[model samples]
Target: MTLTVAAVAIGLMVGSVTPLAFAHLAENTPEERLGRTMGNAELGREVGDAGGPLAVGAIAAATSLPVALTALAAAGLASGVLGRVALRDDGRVRPANPPG
Candidate 1:
């Protein structure tokens, strides 16, 4: 029950945030390259989706499940921090081509 609940919560969070991420990317990317930017972002997401579990499983095989989970969680937190820093602004993503 707990696992199911956690999974649902995670799904909801990801589902909600994904659109926002793409919207932000669209806002920052140039009009000419928006499609390519979106494609690359989706590809990166697919790679992470596949690689994250594989990475955790490899780590667990070498160490332990708890250690692997901890490492994964730590990596997630670090990446979140890095992204926040990289995208820091006045609560808005400025357009790549602002209107005159």
Candidate 2:
């Protein structure tokens, strides 16, 4: 049960983090929003491109295939987290709560 919960928890953690980090790629940016939107888009793709393989291989090496797959998924979650970090708001490209 613990392992099962751990698996689910890990899954949920990855599930939540992935989109938070990388949803910007799938966002629709208008012409004016290009500059700001691209920051996240580029970040999402780049991070995914750079990290995906390393994560898979590293996990595979450290553990078994199944664990490695989990790591790969975790990497995806990380990407999502990273992507969302720089996400721009719609309508104005700038967030309503711009940090002071």
Candidate 3:
């Protein structure tokens, strides 16, 4: 019961912050290659969220829930950081803009 309530509150907080966060983040998103950038973001999110189930089902099989949850949270944080770097306009992840 307590966990459910806490999860609900966290969900609500994320929902509320999402739009505000996106408002600033969208501007930082490279408009030129936006399609690819958004695609990476989408893929990152899908993999991160889905990975927990797969990872837990395998490695977390013997681990306690708290430990598993913490590991999942760390994975999520790392993904978020990676997404920011991956979406940047730098040639590292994003290729240089095509010549006109």
Candidate 4:
């Protein structure tokens, strides 16, 4: 019962952060690449959404549900650390070009 509750809470927390990532992507992307970037983002998201559960299920089958969930939690932590490093920027901002 406690594990189920923790899983649901973690899932909700992770799901809630996706939109913030999308917003960051949208902001950093060049205007010309916006559509392609968004499409790629969507594709990646779809693949993750479909594949994550299947992978977890397979892991659970091979080992146990708790092990599988722990693996996922570790992966999430790794990704969060990597993302923070990759997205870190100094405070400098380039001025936007005046419209022609």
Candidate 5:
């Protein structure tokens, strides 16, 4: 029951964030390459989805489940921080150009 609840919570969080992430990507990406950029982003997401479980399983096999889960959580936190830092805007005003 706890695992199910956690899974549902995580799913909700991912569902909420995904559209925002894609919207940000679309906003920052060039119009000509938007499709390709989205495609690549989707591919990367799929790869990560597949790899994350394998990573956790490997770590669990080597150490313990608790340690593995902690490591995964830490890694996720670090990734979020890195992405936030990388995507932060340097204070500069620019005109908005809407895509046709």
Candidate 6:
């Protein structure tokens, strides 16, 4: 029961994060390369979506489930930091237009 709840929570988190990342990519990308960038991004996302659980399972098998989850959390934090740095505003993304 606890594990089920945790799984649901994690699923929610991943669901939100992935779309937000894609939206950020879309908003920041050049119009000419948007399709290609989105395609590549989706491909990478699919790979990660499939591979992430497998990697966590492998880590759990090698060590323990708690340790594997801890490692995943650490990786998430590190990636968040990297993403913030990479996406830092240098005025590259177009400014949002005022809605009429």
Using lDDT as the measure, the top candidate is 4
Task: Write the residue-wise lDDT of candidate 2 on 25-75 in tens digits.
Answer: 334445565677767666866786688668777877888767876665565
Summarize candidate 6's per-residue lDDT along 2-99 as a digit string, tens digits: 55665676677677888899999898776777899899989988987898899889999999877777677676668778988987878764545423
Clashing pairs in 2: 18-80, 20-80, 21-80, 21-81, 21-82, 21-83, 21-84, 22-80
Say which prediction, candidate 2 or candidate 3, comes out ahead on lDDT. 2
* Candidate 2 segments exceeding 4 Å error: 1-30, 74-100
Clashing pairs in 3: none
TM for every model, in the order presented, reads: 0.73, 0.42, 0.52, 0.85, 0.76, 0.77
Candidate 2, residue 88: lDDT? 43
lDDT of 5 at 57: 94
Q: What lDDT does the true structure give each of the candidates? A: 0.77, 0.62, 0.59, 0.82, 0.77, 0.79
Better of 1 and 4 by lDDT: 4
Give stretches of model 5 more than 4 Å off.
1-16, 94-100
lDDT per residue for candidate 3 within 66-88, as digits (tens), equals: 56556655654675578568665
lDDT score, residue 86, model 2? 55
Sorted by TM-score, highest first, which candidate order results? 4, 6, 5, 1, 3, 2
Clash statistics: count for each candidate: 0, 8, 0, 0, 0, 0
Estimate candidate 2's alpha-carbon lDDT, on a 0 to 1 scale. 0.62
Which digits, one per residue and each the tens of the lDDT, describe model 1 over residues 61-99? 999876776676677667667877988887775666777
lDDT of 5 by residue, 1-96 (tens): 755665565566557666777899999887788999999989988987899889989998999866766676677668777878988888986556
**Deviation (Å) of 93 in candidate 5:** 3.7
| Every candidate's CA RMSD | 3.8, 7.2, 5.8, 3.1, 3.6, 5.3
